[model samples]
Target: MATSNLDLADIQATVLRYRPEPYYGTHVLLRIDDARGGREFLRRLVPHVASAADWWLRDDAWIAVTLSYAGLVALGTPEQSLRSFPASFREGMAARAEHLVDVGLNGPQNWEPPFGSSQVHVALSIFSGDQLKWRQAVETAWAQFRDLRGVTLLMSQDFGAQPGDRNSLGYKDTIGQPAIEGSGVEPLPGQGRPIKAGEFVLGYPGETGVVLTMPQPDLLGRNGTYVGLRKYQSRVGAFNRFLRENANTAEERELLAAKLMGRWRSGAPLTLAPERDDPAIGADPRRNNDFDYANDAHGYQVPFGAHMRRMNPRDTRLAQLTDVNLHRIIRRSTTYGAPYDPDALSERDDEIPRGLYFIALSAKLMDTFEFLQREWINKGDFMTLGRERDPTVGLQENDAVFTIPKHPVRRRIHGIETFNVLRGGEYLFMPSLSALRWLANLGG
Candidate 1:
């Protein structure tokens, strides 16, 4: 049987659109007050929601909305309808609260906020090239709920900076994302294969050659996806201190940082340019993500437990696993707070906040996002590297150590302090464009 074509008009733009034209974004977390009022708010907001078809035509700005599992129920979705959604979404991030702590998600208790808590309901994402324009749009949207008394804005974060792509640790970030088969974006050279669209979008065939069972009533499930949003607080002082302690010269420190991340600060991968940083390769999209772990299987070039390797491991041989593509996900991250200055670390008396707002998208939350966190990131046994964790983002204890395999003998770095601290986050369901309309009409 022939598969049907994807309805771009029915899909949300964020599900397929990789980059939003180098724009600034603001994420607003909302709590629904009244069911009827909330539905009315959705009714008013649906027309402004961007669709997959709008990605090509628009160049200036866009907006998208996703509902938490609680948000769906608050909008008057039936209990039976809610049951069809994934357990991860329905249970929220609190369900995995314990494991999250084990993986360094435990930050200051007061900073937890209402994100993964019961208070959070809806998420509104606005993107625009002009910061003023995006802020105006957000204010206009917030006005609709003000009079209705239907929704309350829980928290908001403004993301993106001038020349706005670098993360807090100051590396050229947002590279190495896989292209979906039908997303109109071509895969970078050496990206292996275009990931199955169904892996990230509903109503499509995934890596397992299955369409992934969707919720009944096509409007609600087709073209929908799931998201995991996390805020990481970067410890610049600790990172600089680690490098100073580990390496003697500035050159060695740079090399050590590159090995730890599997990529140079210029965004170049070590697998391709193991000897030194190559600005030319990092600048070229064709050459950047082209290399895999097949040639450097022993972790000589790129360490086995590097952040990039643990996250993807593309083409790397795993025990009893032929294809690791099933675990791939699309990441859309933005840095928060000001850039950190290593030289001023000692004199900086006050607490200066800076890190990343990490956003990950996938069709199945458990198989892709959660699995990567638990198996690959938090643990290292699968990669044949004993108890060592990811050097870049892993939860580092006093005994934490990272091994860099060399021809003669491996080099080990010990007492690696955790640099990225999790502050707040949540699991949300980004529904289809048609589903947004359905939600608006519900209980009317």
Candidate 2:
């Protein structure tokens, strides 16, 4: 099916669209004290929730609303309907800690307030490219909930976030969100054939040529999708220190950075411009994400264990080759905290609280998002690298080390500490506009 047949107007915009032209973002978690007020909150916010219509157009701002399992219960969803969701989502991010490798410093016990707690029921997010438009949209959402006594704001993170698609780590990101089969936007260079709509939106046929079970009472699940919200605190100082310890000259440090990531800081893929930083190619959307790893099988240009290469591994032969598209998730990641401060380290090793607000969208969170964190990010057996994790964002073992493939000999860089710490995370279900109404009218 093409873009025309898809129910664009019913699906939430965040599911298919990137909230694009990205510049700023906000994440607000809410607690529902009463079922009636929770339903009313959804009712009032329904009109404002963005739809996936004309996804390519440049919207100044967009609002997104999603509910946790607790949020659904607070709205009084039928128990049978509640059981319809996957155990992964029903259990939520904190409960599935061991499976997600959220241990040690990244444990849920250390998570920011209300993130892993059941107190957080609803999630509201606002993204804008314009300040004035962003404020209006945020105020509009606040107006919806402020008057309700049963609804209370739990926490809000990310304001005036980093712009131009650059992450706090200083490398360019948001480069590889897969294209959906019927998302209407023209597929960019590296976004292989658009993924099946069912792979993303609920109630559609996936790549397996089957529709995975949707939540009961079709109104609740159709046109909806699961979301995994993660707040990462980037250890910029540690990251900077790692580079300095590994290399001597500025040029060598940059090359190591490129080797760690699969791209230059400018978003240029190392596969395309291996020897030096190519600002022109990095800035060009057409060419930046187009190249594949097939040509550099040995990972001489792009290390096999590089962050992007591990997350994507485009055209690279895997020991167990599975359809890469099956594991793809749409990432609308945004950066937060003070702009990338190089000197952000304190004597206590307490780095600045700045990192990416990782928003992942997929119909099958277990198969796509969870699987990536498990097999692709935390382990390297699939890539034929024993016990090696993703060098950039993966959970690193205490004695973790990174290996860079070179011509004569491989360069092994040790002290590969975790750069991105999981401050908190949660699983949410973003309902379609119609589903929001269905929720609003429930038990009314």
Candidate 3:
């Protein structure tokens, strides 16, 4: 996960391999008041932090640590080191509300406690499929901070797969993942040659053949990366009602679902199985992300505004407009709350709370995640669809329209609404393992 040295031992495993599939996890935010205590906390937590060495097959559960800009300042980071961070991250997510479309209902002022606020300084995330392992990881983190009065626990949330292992929206999750050059995993059919390590990890050459400028000191930024975590509470009942009112038949409802998502609930992409879903293909990783938009030039199968296509234009002409590769981001999102009843897909049940914790890891926050949020997700002109936004995550109006390009003529479905609402969001920097030790030894 590092440079040519491949210093996996000095880098957090989450930078490359996030959680394994079908995983359960807990995320906790903290605020620090005492610099010495904060450094000591890092001192004790380093041993529990997992590195990228042979990360793919690791059986043990692990915890990843990230710090907001204020966290670094609270830890007594030197002025030079603090000045090296980009303004976007330094300002924090809440300050950029307008740029991220966090305005309206998703504004920072309406966010949950500890989020969208400078009070948040630390984020500890645990990932594991086994209940015991997950519990142990949480307990490990608890042991470190529970007694440290200087460190206050702002909030904690648990996330995993919904019933039948689908996302909150009743669709398969973790469908698309980036293929990084040094990550040991072989690229899937659709995932081209692994992206340059620098595109993801710091201190390496990206696809552009240039090293991404990092934090001032070599130690702090060598393997560090940026992470943007947004808490979304899905309006499941409203979404189900939206589908029921729009489509006439069950089959038509399913088709409409596939069209909206660019993939069927089974995870089969519309490009390969546009007419009907092939669960076999959906379940198969080799074929799931293999197809491109070249054959579907007019977007007959996958619409231009489809979330997947908009996120990763691939080799299509639209890719040129945005240089999709430059803005490619690694997602490791997790669903929170109890699993919903899939049998009653249309039944309204807004009383209970459940949604996704959208996590994105990238080398540069502004050039990647923020870029997509402002240009691609919120605005429609990037791909020539005026006023169209991402149907799933886009901040929509009462009369938003989702155009589905089809045979004979294009079908325009009006009255689209924002399915995912932002309850909380934070931008943090996940430093390298060596940086962790550096922070621990601070003020020495």
Give the candidate number with the greatest TM-score: 2
> What TM-score number comes out for model 3?
0.96
The order of the candidates by TM-score, greatest first, is 2, 3, 1
Tens-place lDDT digits, model 1, residues 228-335: 888787888778878889989877888898988999877789988888889888767788888878889789999988888888888778754647888888887777
TM-score of every candidate relative to the true structure: 0.93, 0.97, 0.96
Off by over 4 Å in 1: 1-4, 20-22, 56-59, 99-111, 162-164, 320-322, 344-351
Write one digit per residue (lDDT tens) for candidate 3, span 385-424.
Answer: 8888999899997799999987798999987888888998
| Model 2 lDDT tens row, 401-432 | 78788889988788998888899999999888
Compared with the true structure, the alpha-carbon lDDT of candidate 2 equals 0.84
Residue 364 alpha-carbon offset, candidate 2, angstroms: 0.3
lDDT of 3: 0.84
| lDDT for 40 (candidate 2) | 88
